[model samples]
Target: MSDSDLIKLYSKQILALATEIPHLGTLEDAEGEAKARSPLCGSTVTVGLALADGKVSRFAQNVKACALGQASAAVLGKVVIGLDRTTLQQGRDALHAMLTKNGPVPSAPFDGYEVLLPARDFKNRHASILLPFDATLNAIDAS
Candidate 1:
C-alpha cells in the first residue's frame, strides 16, 4: 500500500481501539504502575497493571497525548489484556524493532502493532507512540 494509505488505514484502526479515556490518567485496581511524559509535546501516559501467575490480569491507562499518542494507548489497551510476562516483553521488543530498524513484522497477538509501522518515519512522535508501553514496562519492572 502507499505510505498515505498505510497511515490512513493504521490511524483508523488505532483510533477504533481506543474506547474510553481514563479520567485520572490511571488504571483501576492495578498492582503495578508507572507514568511517563514527553517533553517535546508535553504528552503524558500512565499505565497500571495487575499480575497474577506471571500473567497480566488487568491492564489500563490514563493518557493525555496528541492523536498519535492517544491512538497508541488505545491500541495497547486493546491488545495487552491477558498477556503473559514473556508475551508482554515480546510486544515491547517488537515495538522497538519496528521503531529502530526495518525488521520482521511483529508476531501474532502483537501483530496488531504493525499499525504503528507508519509512525517510524515521524521521529519526533516516536516518544508519543512509545510512552504508554514505556510506562507499562516500567511498571512491570517496578513490581
Candidate 2:
C-alpha cells in the first residue's frame, strides 16, 4: 500500500474511533463468550454477552487488534447493546460484502461501519476488521 492509501485507510476519524473502543473487559456471568483472531495480522477480539427476550441484553469485549480492527470494534461497541442475533449476523455479512465485493455499507445502527470502507482494498486487514462482529456473533451462538 502507498502512503496515500495508508493515509486514506487511517484517516483521523478512523484513528479517533480506534482509541475509543467500549465494553473493554470480560463478564464473569456472561451467558456466552467467544474470541476471534485474524491470522494474517495476529489481531484478536473476545466478546462476552448475555441475552434476554432473544436479544443481546449485556455485552463486553476485549479488542487487541490493529487500528482498522479497533475502529470496527468501536463502532460495534457503541451500537450492540440491543441487537439480536439476526441483526448482528446481517451486519457481519454486510460488512464482509462491503470489504470483499464492493457492496454497500452495513445498514443502520451498524452503518457506523462505513468508516471502514476504505479498508476494502486491504484484504489482509479484512479479518481483523471483522473480528468484533465475528466474536460477538459467535458469543451469541455460544450462549
Candidate 3:
C-alpha cells in the first residue's frame, strides 16, 4: 500500500475516536473479564463487565492498541452500558463484515464503527481493528 493509503488508516475521525476512549480503567468488581491480543502487532485489549438483567450495567477496558483499536473501543464505550448480548454480537458481526467483507455500516448505537472503514484497505491493521470486539465478546461470554 502507498504511504497515503497507510496514512488514511489513521484518519482524523479514527484518531478523534481514539482520543475519546471511555471506561479507561478495569472494574474492580467486574463479573466478567477477558483479554485479546493481536500477535501480529502486539496490541492487547482487556474488557471487564458488570452485568445486570442480562444486560451490561457497567463496562471497562484496558486497551494497548493502535489508533484503529482505540477507535473501536471508543465506539463501544459509548453504547456498551445497557446493551444486551444479542446487540453486542451484532456489533461484532457487523464490524467484522465492514472490515473483511465491505459490508454496510454497523447498525444503530454501533454506527460509530463507520469511522473504521478506511482501515479495510490496510490488511495488516485488521487484527488491531478487531481486538475490541473479540475481547468484548469474551468478556460478555464469561459473565
What is each predicted model's overall lDDT from 0 to 1? Answer: 0.74, 0.94, 0.89
- What is the per-residue lDDT of model 1 for residues 1-143, given as tens digits with 9 covering 90 to 100? 58786566457666765544433355667789888999999999987888888777777778888777887776677677677767767877887788778766678776766767777767787788888778888888767
Q: Give model 1 RMSD, 1 decimal.
A: 3.7
lDDT of 3 by residue, 36-142 (tens): 99999999999999889989999999999999889988998889899888888988888889888999999899998888888877778889888888888899899
Best by lDDT: 2
TM-score of 3: 0.95
Candidate 2 lDDT, tens digit per residue, 1-143? Answer: 89999999999999999999998999989999999999999999999999999899999999999999999999999999989999999989999999999999988988999888899989999999999999999999999
Query: What are the clashing pairs of model 3?
Result: none
Model 2: runs farther than 4 Å from truth?
none
TM-score of candidate 2 to 2 decimals: 0.97
**TM-scores, in order shown?**
0.79, 0.97, 0.95
Give the lDDT of residue 47 in candidate 1.
79
Highest TM-score: give the candidate number. 2
Question: How does candidate 2 score on lDDT?
Answer: 0.94
Model 1 residue 101 lDDT score? 83
